[model samples]
Structure formats: structure tokens, C-alpha cells
Target chain A: MRNSFYTAGFSEVMHEVKQDPREASYIYTTTACNSPHRGLSAAIGPALFGTVKSVRALGVQLADSTGGDPDGPSPMDLALTGIASCGVTTLLGGGSARELIFDGIEMLIEYGAPDGEPGQAVRCRLSVDGVTDEPLMNELVEQMQTYSPNMATMIRPVPISFDCLVGTDESTRRQLTVEAEPITDRRPAACRVRWVSGTQLVSYPNGRRMLRVDQPKQLTGVDWGPNPQEYLLMGLAADVADQLGRVAYRLTGERHLWEVSTSACEDMRGLLLKERDVVFLQGVTCRVVVPETLRAETGVEKILTAALAQSEVRDLVSRSNPGGVSLVLGREG
Target chain B: MELNGRTAIGFEEGRSSSAKWFDDLTRVRFAGPVSAHHRLLPRELSPETLAVHAGTYEDPVTGCVGTPVFQTSTFLLDDASYSAFADGAMRDVPIYTRYGNPSQWAVQEKLAALEGSRSAIVTSSGMSATASTIFALTNAGSHIISAYDVYGGTYNLLREDMPSTGREVSFVDPNDLAAVRAAVRPETQLLFFETLTNPLLKAPPIGALAEIAREANALLVVDNTFLTPVNMRPIAHGADIVVHSATKYLAGHSDLTAGAVVGRRKFLDRIWAQTLRFGGTLEPLSCFLLERGMKTLALRVERQNANATEIARFLATHDRVAAVHHPEVGGPHYADLARDDYRGFGGVVSFEVRGGDDAALAFMGRLKIPYVATSLGGVESLVSMPSNTSHSSLTSGQRASIGIRPGLVRFSVGIENVRDLIDDLNDALNGE
Candidate 1:
């Protein structure tokens, strides 16, 4: 279809190279433990902690929660936050696209058990306001689960590649690459969850800067922000909470109050000592709670049950790794 | 009961203190690129003032009077960005340069203001804008109706590329409302036409085409590159989307190449998504240049309009000029519609030399003021013969069949002294 004349016309001898103009490849980068003041300097207050810088040079301090007391938010918190934010936003956008109107939406995340002990899984409680159409709310939940990128990343195995660049100087740079092992077990781990702590700065392709910090010395952070795990739990809660109100309303045709609580268990040995049998994150648990007014209603339990079943984040953590992470290490001299 | 407009959720009303953390998680930065930073002015003000002041991003931090170039490739992502990507609303937030940019936003705001549209999207080139709008609005197996005399690039896209992509196009005379109406297939998704066709200066009945499109449930997309918004805004005349080769009139200088699509927010969002996938996002520097160029759009187009009118009058009676084509020149072709819809005839005037292609080439070679160039709407005048340039893709027979003669020279008049331009034309036309 390059050039076809309706009538017979002279043809030119030419060779052309062409590709689909619409397809493109995007790349994201992050440098862990980079100096705080360097790059865009997104660091808050004194740069006493290790920070991570993205390719765009935006840097934020990292909180190490692997030992003793926590510092700030660890990396996992940010990941969870990403998932939650993605879920909520996806719901908002999808709702708008469908022209489904509603009111205030919020999610409450409960990481561990009420007694502050390691839980079986992460729990999230979702709540919504305004319109209550059980069917419409149900559809929205389905849409959010299907569309949310972070939720999808969690539920489906993501192909991740890690490259290690080790070097004392640019001239002495060397590279190492590693492929992640396949998971043979989908069952929950027998061991309890051991939290890993660290602070990090992540820059997205779209100029977004995020810094994760934890509580004071009690938790290991200076209270710059929520800890990494908090962010993750918060994200899961937000994701499930995004449409629960609508789901409840759609199911019962009456506005119902509810929230999402989520938790996750991890085995410290697998994360710290390279134990093949221990899963770093054993199981993620999620529960939905309704207000006292709706506790007696049979539909309340139905809606709550439906929400947990439909929770994208729960599916992400409960399932075995669906994708592989490949790591490549390189060093600069 | 109503939190914003709808009833507030009971649990969120007594939100826990930790709920504050969700602020960063659920915030949405911009509604979309164009309207997020738009500065409003009295619509009663002149287009010239709107061109200069509308869409100026007031820097609260530095109080910068003009839009500064946002040179970075990525913005600081937050919950808004995360949310935008989740819901197919990437156009609403600034995340990546390709997805959206503040610089692009500033220019888009200005363009939307000038076109009297609710939103606009800037692209790397005019063709990209056109292509994105077409591909986004219409699905595969859709049909399009356009003029036979549309710009050569557009003609090639429809004739050569569209069918292969599962879309069909029908070429017809835009003035023949009956033929245009008759050409609408049940699957016709759009009607594309130039407000002023290239070289020939043929004007389409936009209002009538819009009505036809309405009846057929099709969109009317007008390429308003030549007339621009200063002379005429096709959207006001019922065009659903108005596209421009900012490389030409909108940018007002040959220094940069850019494009714009202006219409409703819903349509612009879809077009923005298509443009993102097409990889035709305008760079920040180019966006800045375009914004700067458009500030003087009203002024530049006014001067070009006056000068082109004078040039057409001079050429109409000249001995070497066999025929002249301009909306203002006496002819029944689209005169009523032009007078009714256009505030001013555009800056381009197409005329035929007494001889054919060679004489026109010789006359162009004799010209001193205007450059021998392919594009129009620059501040500097440009002269090109259709046979040698824009319509070269068409065989002579095909060109003639479309009423483009051998000696048809398109004169894109610039802001030059009309008397000096007349003398230059006189000297060139003498060809002694």
C-alpha cells in the first residue's frame, strides 16, 4: 500500500525499511544506596540513611527494617503502596469510563493480627460511600481487578531482571547476571514471617518521586513517612477498598459500610540465609468487615465474602510466582 | 449526606488518622493534560489577546510570565500518576514525557483557546495529529469520506495506507453536499476535509458537512491549517475536531515542526492515547517554540491575509497570469460559504502562469523575496509549483483530472510589504 496508482504509471526501484509506528519499548531504572544529596535530591531533612536514585536522578533515603527495630518504610511497603494506588486509580478511571457515579472511596489496611502478632496473610478492608447497586459494584470490582497494572503485576508472575554492576572505579567495572529459580510450591510456608527493612527512592517513567520512611526509633525510622510494609498493606487495602462500597451497594441496593484488612507472613530464614524450602512471603490473608448496622443482614456476609474472593492483591500474594526475575550484574571501574 | 455531590461514605466520614497516608495514594493531579493548567480569560476578548494570554502557565513559585520549558523526560510520580495508569487515564496525569508533559500542556491549552475547543493535544507533526485522530476515533472496518483535493500527504494516507489497515476512504468534492451525503456508508465513522484545500483554495461547507455527519452519526474532522483560527474556526462552524500543521501557520515560522488536534475532552483523550502509542509526542523545546510562535498568530495571520489579498488582486489582472484562485477572487465555487463562515480569506493564493510548468518554474526562479519551498504559512513567503512539489505523487493526468494545471503556483503570502512583493511579482512575471 506504499504507493499504488490507479492508472498505469512509472515505478521507482526502491528499498524501504519499516516497522509498526505504534509499538514502543519503555525502560525503568533505580540505583539503591546512592548518595542522598546527589541527583534530584528528593531526600527529606538530614540524609542519614541509605537512599535509592532512579534513572532520572531523583533520590530518596531507604529505611533498613531487616534487623532489630525498624527505621522507616522498607522497599516492600512501596511495592504494596504501588499496588494499592494502582488499584484505586484503576477503579476511579474505570468507573468514570463506565459513567458510574458514586461518592468517597477509602481503604483501611491491617498488616498483622489485632494483637500485633504475625498473621497468616495480609488483610485489607474496603469501604465506599453513596450509590449502592450490588450488580454495578460487582462489575466495577471485576473491572478494577482486570485493569489495575500493579494488581496484575502481583497476580500474574512478572518477568523481572536484576543486573549487578560491581566496581571500585569505572575502569574496574564487571558484570554479573542471574536468573530467578522456578517455584515448585504454592502452599503456605510453615515458618513465621520475618520483616526485611530498608528505605528506597523510586522514580517512575512519569516524573513521580516517592520516599518511604518508617516510625521513630521504636520502628527504626524518623517518621519521615510510613514504613515500606505499611505502604504495601495500605496499597492492598486501598485496592480492595476502592470498589467495596459500590459492590456492597450494588449487591444489596443499600449503602453499606465496610473496610478491608490484610496481612502477610514471611519466613526470615529464606530471605536472610538462602533457604530454598522457605518462602520469603508465605501467605497473604485478606478480610472484609461491615458496620454493626449491616452485621445482621445476610447480604453483608455475602458482600464481604465476595470482596475477599475478588481481591486482586490477595490473589497476587496467595498464588505461586507466575513470572521469573532475571538478574544481570555489571561493574564499573 | 453529599460529600462532594454524592453522599459521603459513613466509615470514611470518621476517617482514621492513618487515613492521611492515603492522600498520596489516591490523589489525581490533572483531569487530563489540556484542561489541568488552562488559564481562563474573557471570551469576549479578541483572538489576538487570547493567543497571547490564554493558556499561560503562571509559575506560582517563580512568577515567571511565560511558560518555561519542562525539559525533563519524567515527572515526579505520585498516587495521581499511579491511579491515572490504572484506569486508562494516562492523559489525565503527568507521568512520562510520552504520556503527557507540562510543556505540551501549555501549548495545548493555548491551541484549545484559539480554536474555541475544550481541549487539544500537541503532536510531533501535523500528519501524526491527523493520523492519531483518525485511528483513535474510528475502528478497523470504518469508512471515511474526504475531499479529493486534500493535502497530498493526507491523500496518500487514505489511498495507500487506510485500506491496508482495514479502513476505507471515499474521495469526493466537498462542495457537492449531495455527493458527500450520498457517500456516507452505514459504517462511515468520519468525514475529513480541509477548510481550505491546498493550492486550489477550495472551501468546504463545514456546517452542511457537520449536519450530514450528524445524520450519519459520523464525526467531522477539519484540517484548519491554511485559514487557521484567526480567519475561521471550523469547530465553531460545527467541526468536531480541528487539526493543524503547527509547522505552518500555528507555529508561524519555519523554525519548528509540530501539530495540534482540538476538540472535546473525550475525543482529545482518545487521541492523546493514540498519539502516545504512535510515539509522536512533541518535545518540550518544540512545545515552547510553538507556544511562543502562537502568541503572535493573530498578528501574523492578519498581515499575511492582507498581503495575500493584495497579491491575488495584482496577479488577477497581470498579463502573464492566465488564471487566479482565491476565495476572495470572483467565482461561484464556495464563495457564499467562504463569505458566510470565514472572517478573512486565507494567506495562500494559487494562480496559473500564462505558460505551463516550465514558465512557472522560470518565474519562481526569478522570484527574490519568497523562498522556493514546499510548505506554507511561515512568516517568510514560499512559492512552489504543484507539478514539481506537493502533488508530484499524482500523475499529470491524475493531477489534471483534479483541476491542478501544469503552471499552478501556490503563493503562501507572508507578512511582507505588499508593494515590494508586487514589484517582485511584477519583475518575475515580466520574464523578459
Candidate 2:
């Protein structure tokens, strides 16, 4: 006997075994599937794939090979890629998404490794570019934080475990293991690695390297206090390059090598101690080595002037104290 | 009243006309050779001498021979055409005070000339200038390589705030050329440090750092706050950008807080745009004060430098002093960088007192002339214990690793009578 039942705008029992064999079989199946229109999936899937493919295609090869593992990108390199890619993608896709036009995009990334750490200890820099409107550009940059995958990864702290081994001799072996808590607090985390012989390697997860005993030769004449403002340094340089490049391209329709190099010194003690409010004394020196042809067409000073005037990050880091509280921690032997 | 035709004609038509008055004022204040002074001086003079003379324009109204304070906040335009001039649509026109005023431009011109930079922009405070520069240069998700030890405010901005915006920073030792080179990736943008560090007084080897930064294709930024341009010119040593916390030494009076970034015109233009948008421009009155302060900078800094050197020497020999960290006093090998990068020793000295924090604080309390305060680069001497004062926020372990002991004292020497200063220090250290 066949029976009919109605449930919330649908007929359940109407699909009886003999009357609706296919519908009953579908309901009984273990695997559930909801199919979309072929045309829609095909169009949307390709567009998404194309967007990601375009981003990956724009990668630039780093010239140096020492900082990271030989086989893969170092944390610093990954960070750079992450920042650059996020900026580029956000600027490009963000503008298209919002129905705006952007002539060009430029980004710069900078970071520092902490003492006794194999990866980046400090990460700071700026990203500046010309857009249609100043306010709109700022809004896009702000919104990008919510969407940038790489940036999201950086803000979330990851659990880190370290395994240290000493002695080069095959027969001799010593291992030290330490696990650090997730870095939720903004204060610098001081961690100590005690060498079996009582040698201490102090590491600040968020602070910079002041001195290293293993590499004492490199510590000569360095002021450990006035270190660089990590992000500001990169921002200044990148902005300079961007401005110079824009001027050059506008004037000559060609892109030239526009580079900036920056460095600073800081008193390590002041940063680590609670006495000095200012720690690193950041300094940036840029040499815009332009092609001779472009240099001739656009006065070097003029180009440089435009570049300096155009830079925003240089103005910010050089202007005020971006606010924060300082904290100190102790590592015991 | 008798109507005199001759006098009326003279006043209204020819000799005493409004045109004549305008022409006379223009000749004295804005005529050919006088207006040319702005462009010519920067090109012809050396930075050291220019720092002293760049903005000493005689007052048009009073002939004061010093840059006068134009305290007005707005300017009256001559006609409706001035609207375009005010909005940067026209060049070389005086329009609004916010865009550019005579007083502000005078200081800007002086700073640019003194730094031997293409141009410069002034801001309300040191940090504002720094922030403007950074904002102009970078956007979200950029990379930078920085020295490990940095100003606390800047450290926090980079470490905590910048990451939220997608920017990343790496801190490394400036002295480590290999490390600096290693730190640079394809997207690395800039490197930064100070010419002479504050409090700790460590000096970086600019030449080597510049070389490393160049190889990595990054811009080098030098903070000339402590040393001032009088002691060191980072540009001459291959710096791309130079910044100063003018509140400390450049202003000399402790009255005004200002900052400046000096670099090539191309880069400065970007910074200028950011400054305008951010509204961090230095007021005209502050610019006048800065100009006034600059006139005596050479004299004040010279005396201050001498005083600091003397004090550093005195502290080195003191029985209460354990170790002095002045770059000049250290061995040739220890401070070889000072010889290469700096022309003179700066006015900051860091030393460890014999006693710990309690005794250090007591010594500071005993001092009469030197104020026991925070902030350096004032005309009056200042002293403070780092472990308890400047770096008190840091953890004890962090302090120990960096060699900041509880007994450490950072002294900012001023241009006061050296004999009296020495006597005050002696009494304090001797537990008077």
C-alpha cells in the first residue's frame, strides 16, 4: 500500500518506492550532493584560480641565499613575500573590487632577528603607493588587514619549540629542549638557552639582538641602543623608491634601478632596561643609482626631491611616538 | 579746510601712490636678489656654515636682523586668483599659512641647507616627523630591516602596531654586515639607525652599514638626534635619509618639540604630501623659534661638546664610577667607528655607578645643577638611572642581558660652566 505525507512545503511520502524510485534512492544514499549549475561553477572557479595564479606569477627571486634554510624560504623571506604579495593583491584586487583605478603599487618590507633566534626577531616596515584618493587609499590599506592571508598569519602567534644540539663529534651528543608559551602579551619575551658548560644565550622573542658571545668579532663599535625603527626603515626606503620610479616612468617611460639602504644603532641596555624610553636610534641612507640616460633627462636632484616629498612612511616614523607600553622579562639559568 | 590740488595729486596719482608703496615694500622684502637668497644659499654654502646662517633674514618691518616670529595663522590673498595658488595649482605664490608661510619656509630652507639635503619638512614633534616619513614611504605589508636596539616608541610601533597593518620588521645588529646582508630579502625596503645613540652612547660604523645596505638594495636612514649635524653628517657617509628629534638639541631651549627628515627632493616630496594629509605640519611660530634656536646652535653645541668630553673624562677617573661607555674614551679598536663615521664626540655619557639603583638615585638626588629628569639634549645638564628610569619598563633579565645594571647612569652634558658642573658631580658622587 502507498501512503502520502506532507512536511513543511514538501511531500515526503509522495516519493514511494514504485512511484518515485530515483527520488527514494537519492534520499537513502549515504553520500549527499548539492550540484550547482555547470556554467556558474566553471566561470567562478576559473576566476578564483586566475586571481591566485596571477599573484603567484608575480614572485621575484631574492638574490641572497644565506638567511633561510637552503631548501626553502626563511621566515624573513616568507614574511617579505607575504607582505609584498598581500599589499600587491590587496591593492590590485581591492581596487577592482571597489571599481577604482590605480596606476601603480609598491610595497617594502623590513624585519630583524632577535638574539639567539634562528628566525626574525623583529618585523617592521612601511608600504606606500599612489592611488586615486588619499583617504580612499588609506581605507583600502586598513581593509586589507582583514583580508590578507599572510598578514593574518603574522598577527596570530604560533607555538614554537626548539631543539638544540651541541658538539660536532659523532660520538659526543647533548640535546636541550625548550617550549615557549604562545606570545599573547605584547611585551618582549626573554628566553634563555643554557649551554651545558654554563654559557648563556639570551633571546628576546620580540626584541632585537644587542650582542652575541659566539660572534663577538661582529660586535665592534656598535651602539646597542639606538636601533632602527624596524618598519619605518623599510617604509622610508620603499617610498623613496616608489616616488623616484613614478617620476622616472612619467618623464622617460622607462623603469630604472631605484634603491634605498637604511641602518640604525641603539643602546641595547636602554631597550632591555626600563631607564631609556627610546631604544634604537634609527638612520636611513638611500642612494638612488639611476641609469645614466634617465639621470640626464630628469635632474637627479629633482627626481630625488620628488621621491622624498612623495614618501609617507618616512614622515610617520620621523614624526611621533606611535603609542605602546614597554615590558621586561627575566630569563633564569 | 583748503583743498590743495598739488598735494592731492601727489597723494593720489604719481609720487605717493599705492603702487609706489607696494613696489618699495616688495623691493626690500621680495625683490630679485633678496628672493634669490633662498635658492642661492643652499647651492653655494657648506652645511656647517649654512646651519648658522641659512635663515637669518632681517625683519622687513623692524630690521631686527633675526628671523621674526610671524604668529599669524592665516594670510589674506591679493585676489581670487590666489585660490589656485593656495591649493598648489600655482608656484611661488604666497597664499595660505597652512601650506607654506614665510617663517616656516625660512626654517625649512635653513634645515635643508644645513643638512646638505635636497629639501626638508618640519613637523610639530620629532615623532610626528618620523611618522609622516614612514607613512609616505610604505603601505600595508612591506618589509624593513632595523637595528635591534631602537627607541621604545618606535620599537612598539614596528613590533606591535605595524604588523596589524601587514607590515613586518626585522631587527639585527647594525655592526654585523653579514647579518644585515642576510636579513635583506627581495622585498626589503630600508635600513635604519642612529648616528650617536642616546643614553647608551654606542656609535655605529656608518660606512660599512651603508655598504651592506647598498648591496642589498635598501635605503639607509640615519637618526642624527644625539650627535646633531655638528658632530656627524650621515649623508656625507652615504645615508639616504636623515632624521632629527629637534626637541632635544636642535631647539636647545627645551621649549619646543619638533622633528625633521632630510633627504633627496624626490623622496621628500612624497613625505611632504603625507605631512599635509596627516596635518602634522610645524606651526609658523615653532618654525620661528627653531630658527632662533638654530642661530646659537653652533656656539651652544661647541660648549656642550666640550663640557661632555670633560665630564666623561672626569667620570672615568671617579672612584664611584665602574665603567664609562663613551665612544671617545674607549680604545681605538673599541670605537674605531667613531673615527670613521663621526667628526666629534657627542654630549651623552653612560657609566655604571659603584652603588646599585638606590645609591644611583641618591647620587642623582644629591646633584644640584643637573636635573634628574628623562629627555636629553637640553642646555641644562640631566642625569638618570637607566634600570629604574629610561628602561624601567624592561624586565630584569632583559636588562641584564643588555648590560644595563641597576647602577648605570646616563648623563646628558649641557653648555653650563664646566667647573660648576664638575663640582656638582663630584659632590654627588662623593656622597656630599
Candidate 2 per-residue lDDT, tens place, B156-256, comes to 66677667755678887666667878887645656777776645676778877787667655567778888887777788788888888888888888889
lDDT of 2: 0.50
Tens digits of lDDT, candidate 1, A165-269: 112223322332222233222222111111112221231211223343332211112233543333444444443443455466567665544444444432322
**Ten-residue region with minimum lDDT total, candidate 1 chain B:** B2-11
Q: Go through the candidates in order and give each one's DockQ.
A: 0.01, 0.01
Please give the distance, in angstroms, between residue A15's alpha carbon in candidate 1 and its true position after superposition: 51
- Alpha-carbon lDDT, every model: 0.60, 0.50
| Poorly placed runs, candidate 2 (over 4 Å) | A1-333, B1-48, B58-63, B77-94, B331-333, B338-340
